[model samples]
Target: MPFDFIFNFLTNHSLSFSNPSTHLSYFGSRIICYHLPHNSHRNLSYRSILFLLTIDTLICQNCLLNQQLYASALLHSKSMILLFSLPIIVLAYVLCRNIKLYYDLHRRGLNPQFDIFGIKGLMWLDSSAAHENFTRMCSVIGDKTFSVLRGATPVVVTNDVDLIHAISTEHFDCFHSRIPEVLSDDPITSENIHMFSAKGERWKRLRTLTSYGLSTVKLKLLFPTIETCVSEFLDHVNSLSNGHSVVINHSHSLFQNHTSYVLARCAYGHKEKNHRVNNFLGVFSNAFGAFSDFQKSTAEKITYFFPEMRLIFKNSFVGHFLQSANQQKFLDYLLHLISRFRSRTINENNNKPSEKEPDNYSLLEFFFDHHNEKKLVEKAEGQIDMKKVKVEKSISYQEITAQCKFLSVAGFDTTANTLTLLFNFLAHNPKIQDRIFNEEIKSHSDKIDFETVCSLPLLQNCIFETLRLFPHASPLQTRICTEPLQIGKYEFSENIQVVINPWGPHHDRDIWGDDVDCFRPSRFEKLTEQQRKAFMPFGVGPRQCVGMRFALLELKTTAFRMLQKYVVKTTLPVNDSHGKMVNMTVRDTGTIWPTDKLGIILTKRNT
Candidate 1:
């Protein structure tokens, strides 16, 4: 037999070596000596078989020992890991369960109230808990006194009209805008004309600047620019229609473009040629993508959990991008415009130029005039720091730019969302849509003037009802108390945040009656003269939306023009999901755009 065959044959037959000790001894002695190869070929073959048997025996013995050792280590390691992590996991589960239980209990009239320490107490009024928890808080607390939330923060929850009016209007200075950590953390937020800014002098100065720059007169002057943009928008829509039914993403590209163009033109006196297809819309789209990614990170969750995360991550990718692109663009554009306007004004002033002026009137020009007046006052008073005054003078340019950018973002998305809601409502309630259409037709003569458009009472009512039922900035308004103040029987100390739940108030049965959820425009019509004062869609008091007029005009004008041109219909079954809206401004944040699965189809209307 071959040497290999002999080795295998011997190894297989080795099982017959009955005594384990005898087998080991024979293998070791033969295997150790046979490698010398001084004997015959049979001796060599026997030696090779002995060597193979010895190696196999040793490997088997080692493997058996290792297997037992590994099993014992694995069992011990598993038990230790379980022991270490079990309590932590259990604690997390218990806390989450308690939160849910507390929320549920509050929702169902249990009225269990407790306070835990820290800033996380704001979580009680956060959007996640607002719907149920806030409602329960309002019912149980009843505006009698401010309750301290878990995190050592005091909060006042109320639906009482007198108390709300007192806090929002009468003693407005005592309970000014909320100072959110997000706003205070970023320079853009700190420097901008956000609604969340401090009250009194700072708010007064900013508000005055904004009013001058974005005033009704200014908006009226800018109307032609908006009209031109909207005309282009209509053309784009017509081109897209192309005789075939098309599914359009209304909130994304189309609205974004129109809005960007409107802002660029109105704010900077510059309009990009492909604003609808490129420019700020693209920037916003990219920024939103980056925002979504950043939001997914554990860092984002931590930042949300602790406001101090904002301090650490002040230069977050999303925040920086927003400031650089949106904030910086507007700032630079405004500053450049201001410089040019100031140079031209200086030349004109020296020459005693006529008040008739040039065609390129801008918001910057208004600001320049306002700044001059302020400078004159400071000069006469002799209390001015020329350096600080110079800085303050440049503020208008930056402030107006910030406000304009905010309008572009806030006004655009909210208006589009409101329009979507209105259209969805009309799709379901054809009668109401028809009423609006008929009113528009009746109101429009050969030419529609501003006064004629404004005169349509029913149209106004329809718009009001749509806004009330589906307010775009549903839960956006927040305010922090700077000083201890009483609202009804509740006394809220300084640093306590108050959230004005517009959606809750709008949907409240006590406020709007049992049919509050229903889309009944007649409800607005039937509102007693006294009741109308409490129904604030644009909010109330001095800190109310500054761009309310502009937004209203845009919405009304768009609705009227669309009604004049086309009758909107939906191919997809008109459902809530198809017309779902989101609250962008307030406590919660998510995909606020209407889904692609839902949309309205428009057909030409006969005059």
Candidate 2:
């Protein structure tokens, strides 16, 4: 008891002693520890400092005591040495590993150095001003292609059209799949891994299934359902307009109602419900809302920046934490919808419409049939290894949910941003709006069917030009190397990230002429060979967006209806500019978005 009390008193009081050696001597080892024998060596586990000091005294008793005291002094010095050295060792290992990775990338022609061990880069990426940061990144690295260290991962980012074409098309086999940011291998997330993440033959099969799901006949069938939704949107607009110019984005999002209804009918096999529990769209909106701004968790911030952390994070509690709470509303709704669709599919008239869901031959039902939901529903847990999917006749159930999730997001966010920017451009350029009304809108009948809108090339051009400006998702698209490959003179290792920046080439003076910054739909009229290859709003080649035709239809149909009835005007000045929409700011939060409020003036037109 006396020895324990002495050890505690000395160790606890040593905190304020400025010099560690002096503090150890002040422990009065001459008085207390002089009874023990002197032996320079003593064995004590690293787990406890108290045990270390106590054992040093005991070991000394077995030998002989001296005036200078024995192993007690040695223990103090050794414990302090180990404590001080550990952190420096850790810091050295971290620095060496990062420097080695960066050096390898530098040798491969990735230039100008990257953020110090990616700390600064991580902060910049996690910041909401990613677009602005990218512009700054382009300035330092130049407008052409360059590689940078995204954490320790080697990411090749480029605006080079030839290189983009070569990788995405000509050299497709070498760079076909993406490294997903969030690592998820759950039965549903793995099989239903969104379009970009699935690699090789499995990816090809998924694309085929999705492409078939959006066939011309299916689009034609789904057109009426979409048209009806758009009409309701226009009616809502009319009620707000009140026979005068009105702002479209005050109380709620500009296109939220319109997109929600369309997704409800097309993806959910039902009308959009207004109730809190049943409204899948509302729940879905709120779930992603959790990621907005500063709400991001610590685990999310780490994994989002480091692609290598995907596998580890997916297997952790953070993944569950993210899904169980923030996403529960939508997950519950999705499961409910799945149950309903499952019930209906087993009935006598499986392929036909039910009285309750007149538009029951939905995209949801179509995807389920292809996935062979019967098998998927049996084993709904654990992930499917996509690499060995040679004989798997159908995708799993989780794959079906994953597909619908992508559709819900892409179909809503991307199409919404395009419409927002389109309105702004049209509002500022009255002449272009007038030309569309006279040449396209007036030529067409009152009907806004899929076939009628498909024939409007000029209107289609406007949509193309707007997308050329804003792009389909983020200006940044990503892929990963499947094997050792060469692009130009640079040879890359397998699993390297290949980022395609559509923003750079889209605004390149060499490709789009000096008026590249201008909002001119006419530029798309006369295209050079290079320009056509450079234009990749919905990605490129076989891996391009499967819903391209559907997206175009939505744009044309919505634009036709809105333009036919209203003349758009906005708060922005019409002078000294060709629709100079520089006042508005855009950013990428997984997808491109207009951060400013989406408000435009709509004057009802009497035709």
Candidate 3:
């Protein structure tokens, strides 16, 4: 319609001209006819037409530019969406694969029943069944590397014997035991020189010092003290048995008490009465309970996905009560004992006018003498060179206290637990127990010396069997890899922690026969030299238990004296309260002890 309007207007206004150029000029002049209409209305009309054409040109250019920008923006939006979504898609696929692997492993019966978390099993194994379950899990997994729940934290479990050997021996420096932060938060942890607390140089020094103290010569020197403690323990037991049936929680009150007295006299030069209430035994028992509880709680919390809850839960009444009362009381008592010794030493030194005063024959005194002599040697060497030098001595007040405290804590409990379990085993297996008794009696009628007791083959076998079936510390010994270690087929990187389950290895079907769980002392007799080496009840290599000889002596003497007078028996049904024994120690509660309470029916054996 616009085209028709333009044509009609042009045709009606047409003025014919001769040449084409002349015609275009004539049309241009006629198109501006509105401006030359000889009136103001015509001029206004011409300006309106020019303004409309300018606006049209600007609008068309803007439309074309906007179309190009919109297309480019759409392309960029698509690229960004793809880039961000790619990672999510990959993550989803990986998660699905992991879940599938977990299910497949489970469905194939390759999963350990106790490993509920699929990472590491629970941190606390308080039952024999749990121990058994863990062993089974390791066997089924049979992999160089696998994961299990240590409470909530996932720990990678390895059955690589090479790794175990490396950790136990080659990489001993890297694989030292870890002391939980909670335990170290208090002075008790700091001042205790127990094997658990000893690490690096401090550990090395204390270990060397204690090793000397527990040497064959020192043990012989300490024989009388040990005998005295054991006699007292036997007397206590005899007094309690009135020819009637008696219930004995030997692990808790009796054996633990006796061991405490032995350590007290042998290590600290103090002999506290074990039978009395509120003595060292009582305090130690309370302290141990507190320590165990604290460890369990810490292990549980740290393994949790949300470990920050530990801080919030720290204000709980039980937590505060243990820290303020039990822990603090133990520390205060230890510090007081250390102070008393220091005062005595100071007075003795002051009283001696002569420089050649003979040293007192106490462990503490010996330590101080050596420590001072070391300082003197260092000072003399420095003076000869005219060099300023500082000599750090052994037996610092703190070191002495820590070492003594460690002895008191570790020595007593572990030995007591072992003895108690052994006793329980002897009580149930009267034939084996009686053989040990007869051997002890034949060795020495009145007094069984260290050498005599150590010679009894039957007694040694019994002890070895007890240690194997009911090791005090059940889990495989752990060590961190300090340097790269090659054990057998595998290589472990430095700083990775490795654990060897002694219980697992001891009970392994490949190593032991199908009757591995049976209480058989004769297994030792059948073992080849290689097998015997593998059966390390007290561990192996340089870092083995320092006080093993002392522990054996104590066990032999205590077992001999107890058995000579009494025939241990169980009056209660064997399986009635078997559950309580699970958390007690690694020993077999049922086989070693009767169910209700450990009833040792004492009968006077006429010599």
* Candidate 1 pairs with clashing backbones: 116-150, 117-151, 118-151, 145-490, 178-479, 178-480, 476-586
TM-score of 2: 0.79
**Cα lDDT tens digits for candidate 1, 142-256:** 6422343433333445444565667677766665554454423432234455434434444555565666666666766766666666666766766767464344645334555
lDDT of the candidates, in the order given: 0.55, 0.67, 0.55
How far residue 142's Cα lies from its native spot in candidate 3, in Å, is 3.4
268-303 per-residue lDDT for model 2 (tens digits): 687553322336557767766323333455665666
Highest lDDT: which candidate? 2
After superposing candidate 2 on the true structure, give the runs of residues whose Cα lies further than 4 Å from its correct spot.
1-80, 124-127, 186-192, 250-252, 273-278, 289-296, 300-312, 344-359, 373-393, 575-589
lDDT of 3 by residue, 456-536 (tens): 778777788777766555443454444554545445444334445565666665666776666678777778654565576
Query: Which has the higher lDDT value, candidate number 1 or candidate number 2?
Result: 2
**Number of clashes in every candidate structure?**
7, 7, 13
lDDT of 1: 0.55
Candidate number with the higher lDDT (2 or 3) = 2
lDDT of model 3, residue 548: 84
TM-score per model over all chains:
0.65, 0.79, 0.66
